[model samples]
Target chain A: MSELIKNFTRELPDWKPRVRPVNLDEATEAQLDALKVTPSNTKVSDYVLTLAHDVESLKIRSPLFNAIMYDKGGLKRSERELGAIGASVLNRCIYCNAVHMNRHAQLEKDTSVTDSILADGENAKLSSRDQAIFNFSLKLSSCPPKVGKEDLIGLEEAGLNIEEILDLILSTALFGWANRLMHILGDPVKLENNDS
Target chain B: MDALDTTTLRAAGLKGSLSAAAALQQRANILHLTQKAEAAVLRPKDFGAYNHELRHALAGRICNLNGDQITADQYSGNAGTYADLIDPGNDGGNYDLEQLVNFIDKVATRPSDVTEEDIKTLQKAGVQDPDIVRLSELNSFMAYQIRLIAGLRLFKEYES
Candidate 1:
């Protein structure tokens, strides 16, 4: 068995659940529906299968997650990934951080930003816009959510309009939700071959 | 229900501003799904040990810990027997939920610090795995909702 990955990396890690995931064969109709297990679409990640225990939330969360992260016309997709990465980093969700960091790198086609974040965390030197986005997300991810007017000022000054800021907020806050479930219920492990 | 009339937008008090309201409306689908997700977590069809009232209490507790009094009050009004747990100062000793409440509070306030031992502690205390997932969804959703409200309120304030 591979050891749990502790530090954040741009490489996507495999998530191993601590609790028993719902057995697909024995899953209730509700769980199956939430998992969306058509014969042709039977492949589901263990992380998602674990969430299927509470099938109701799982059903609704998927669309909401996609809309917040992938919906066009607001914050850029890569910047939204930055918001997710910021929250994941603060929560020490190695899996969430790794996934979004890779996405951010892919979208931006430059690894320097994620490289700096993986190496230096909140103090990573970034462009002013990236700094504002990262700082606000990190603050919002904390308990009691340490954001203030200056954080908003930082975004506005960094040239984010209200729509972009709202998207940033949604993306950041959404990961506050994701990090808890991902970090608390599982561990990020080395991507083993045969994990297909 | 209007998509804009979600518990999240209401808790944020996101009214009286045309642009803020418009910004939210532009993502109406997300807001609508968010409301649905709230119902699914807060009042699911097959909630096990954590019934609707208990879920509300837990949600209230998480909101309070996150310092969002408005959102906390929204959940606390329905907290009933679990009202006392909304305050961080009061542990769950009175309700035979000391262990469960501790797990909830720790996961809510210090999620990064939560170790596998925390989940093990809950299991040792007789929390079944399914209920554990239910508890986590409630806590996790409340974290998202609270931060959403906080962020909207910040934007509203900035607009004014």
Candidate 2:
């Protein structure tokens, strides 16, 4: 009976696989070349290469990438990832959410905590600073102009410096733009079949 | 950077081009209007009417607003009441002066104190002058969007 209920509640028509302009293999090459670096010597296929390239291209173009990778003057990598994940979740980008969630899990083994954050939001277990970041990201994602002075003050109170705060805002803004692009373009392809 | 170099950069990315910057700035302004529109949260019918009125008001073009004239090719697939006409992807109209000033004042000044009447006052006081109108609209929209985004952050802050 439980099985029947579960099956009954399942989506009537499983989502048909979305067709993409670039094939997995060709996209891999484009992604790798855009990043301007070769993939790891491990037996990486075109898909992996493409994924790396996409990240690399984003690194050069996106303020969000700089915030996550280089701008750790005040916030830790985990905190940055948390904010990013929050934004991705708010934007409803399953690809970005999944990618950042996996990264968070890689940093911390407790997947349930990350899952909870994904389920709820920045209100999930995190420092006040991280909470501030998550809140900021969500606002930026949903209604950008609604972000006001009080929000900046909150981050300042949370101990983020002016530069870090600026980075956070820019990162959030960049992701908002990127999320729109991703939403319009297509679903994010899985880098590996085994990836959760 | 040299003119040639600047041109090259502009070609490479949307952020790099003068036109692209203008587009982004315009988008930021529209986002602000959309926020205000959403806060008011008009019924679908009213929202659609208001969107139609606003587009005609801004563009000076009597568009059908019900997607009558819009073709599939022009569809930008943006999610908004005015998505058909004002979709960032659509190259319909440039920034208007009056709208630009309102957007700017909203950002630099406290919007809470400013009334719609004040906006009208500003508009009447030569806010829509051709000189600096285009640039002002672009700059104001970008600034306003940023500030609005900042304000939204505050809203979320209190929630936290």
Candidate 3:
């Protein structure tokens, strides 16, 4: 019998993260300060909060994520999400996959495109532009060297200027780190059963 | 890596201001920490390592990227090296940090595969919880940095 599921991202799980995150009360002053600057503010994501152990790194990492993913002006927010989702999928971080895939769906005008990419990026009916981004992202996430100049050239050919090219690179790079850590730090999910 | 402001670089060849590059330079703040973090892990007041080869199988494998040689070579000169630890396939030379490094590498590649047993192994190797977190962070950071440069290399190498 096929299992009935309501939502893939949100309804998926209330699973526990592998490592215990610092509770709001347990956070040091520096960690609290770092949390403040992040997009979620005191509502820190498990991934961001785990870095509270090394507040200095969190201070550095948080702003970098903001600039690359949220600061705006290079790639469209949706495009950045595309790169993020691609890397997350390849790295096998279900936590990141849930977060970024949902974001991709939200930012994109059509959820179907995001859904298609999620199913099978290689066969997804993405426009050449997104295809370029997806191909570059997949290559970078798996075997970085297999990627080369021609890859960026294809992006350029797809009409992305050099700046957009760089934006794609940065977003993809940030997620590389983000996915790697998130995988180790914990899984993401909202548990069912009234917080049981 | 002359540390050119991304704004200036964009102005030279690119037509428009790519805010992400400037944001990356001004806001990402990782470049600033890269040196210190690199030191804390690779050098650590111990031996020096320039490239990723590490003269140690564990660290080398942990650092393994697509273009193993090129990826290994990527960090040379910029990060500074006090130890001649670049010789490939050599045992960790003089450090006993291999166990933790290998464990962190395993976790980074396959987090779900990690179990309590892995943590126990690290503990048996005399690794503390704090050190484990640090090692895990370093592994993740390396993955991030390597991917960034690898992607950028395309920009630098591609004539277009």
Candidate 4:
């Protein structure tokens, strides 16, 4: 029995790091240039680089990349980060949740609101549109198959056009895949460690 | 175009090809939000199974043509594979939604020293109506099963 168990364990692949965090100074100038356009500082810059590299290493590109780079239907930086945070929260990715929550705070200068949203998504004091967006993101992150006409109707009620909804779905799906990859590969590193 | 149609036509004209792209983007966003709403209702521990179910449902292709009388094996090959979407896992699986629901109900209904924060955490982890109404209540799960039967639906529509 022990031998069978050992064989089963051995058949499982060894763990490997999909992404390693890199320092800002160590990143290429091209990377720094990319960060500059997105209104990032050293800390945000390093995090983005690490996240990008990790994503690339995983053989995945976050839908967030498009939201950031192409401005896909003008998805703001805050909203994009909110989507990431929502996914991390759903996936129970402590590392991602902490990282995204902190980044949102830095950018928005309102930790309390972010904290509230993380706490109670539906009743958070966000604008109707933001609440709808967050609500939609939460549902997508947690239970995708359940999505239906009513949900779409709610988005329409929230005044989001079809294009905006598509962008949100892409972002949510990208993060959903990402959260799974991160969870299976390894728990996120601590937020303190994530920074350096 | 009539007066109202003129405004509509003008907006359409201005939107041009962007409308198609925008439509695709909007669909993607709705998918994302739906996932998030489901996640908000789940507990942290339940997330794994929830993830599995979401993927299974999204990927499922089976349908129940005559109602609940059908058994899994009775259906012609792969006919009801998609049925797994609504059914919870077998005897011993960590990702069972029923188990998660039971657990959440216990916590939500019980009296304990649990703080508001703790309750909130549990709430955040649970899967609620906005997250799953379509699948469980509106029979979107059946629709998904039908799509699988027809092979005409865009699977990526669920992917986001």
What DockQ does each candidate score versus the true complex, computed on alpha carbons? 0.87, 0.06, 0.36, 0.04
Question: Whose DockQ is greatest here?
Answer: 1
Candidate 3 is graded, for docking, as acceptable
Which residue ranges in model 4 land beyond 4 Å of their true spot?
A: A1-72, A121-125, A189-196, B1-160
lDDT of 2 by residue, B86-120 (tens): 33233333433344434433322222232335434
TM-score of chain B of 2: 0.23
Q: How many residue pairs of model 2 clash at the backbone?
A: 16
True contacts kept of each: 0.82, 0.07, 0.45, 0.03
Chain A TM-score per model, please list them: 0.97, 0.61, 0.81, 0.59
| Per-residue accuracy of model 3 over B1-160 as CA lDDT, tens digit each | 4344332233223222343355345433444444344444444332222223342233334445334545454344333341233332333435655665556556646654655567678778776544555566566666665666666656545634
Backbone clashes in model 1: 0
Each model's TM-score?
A: 0.98, 0.44, 0.73, 0.42
* Candidate 3 structure quality by residue, lDDT tens digits, A10-64: 2244334455567888766666786784446556656566666655455566556
Q: Record all residue pairs in model 3 with backbone atoms less than 3 Å apart, i.e. clashing.
A: A14-A190, A14-A191, A64-B28, B48-B83
lDDT of 4 by residue, B26-107 (tens): 4343334333322322211233224433433322212222121222222232323434433323211334444333332222
Question: Model 1: clashing residue pairs?
Answer: none
Question: Each candidate: what lDDT?
Answer: 0.90, 0.40, 0.59, 0.40
Native contact share for candidate 4:
0.03
Per-residue lDDT, model 3, residue A164, is 79
Please give the clash total of every predicted structure, in order.
0, 16, 4, 44
lDDT of 1 by residue, A28-84 (tens): 888888898989998999999999999889988889999999998989999999999
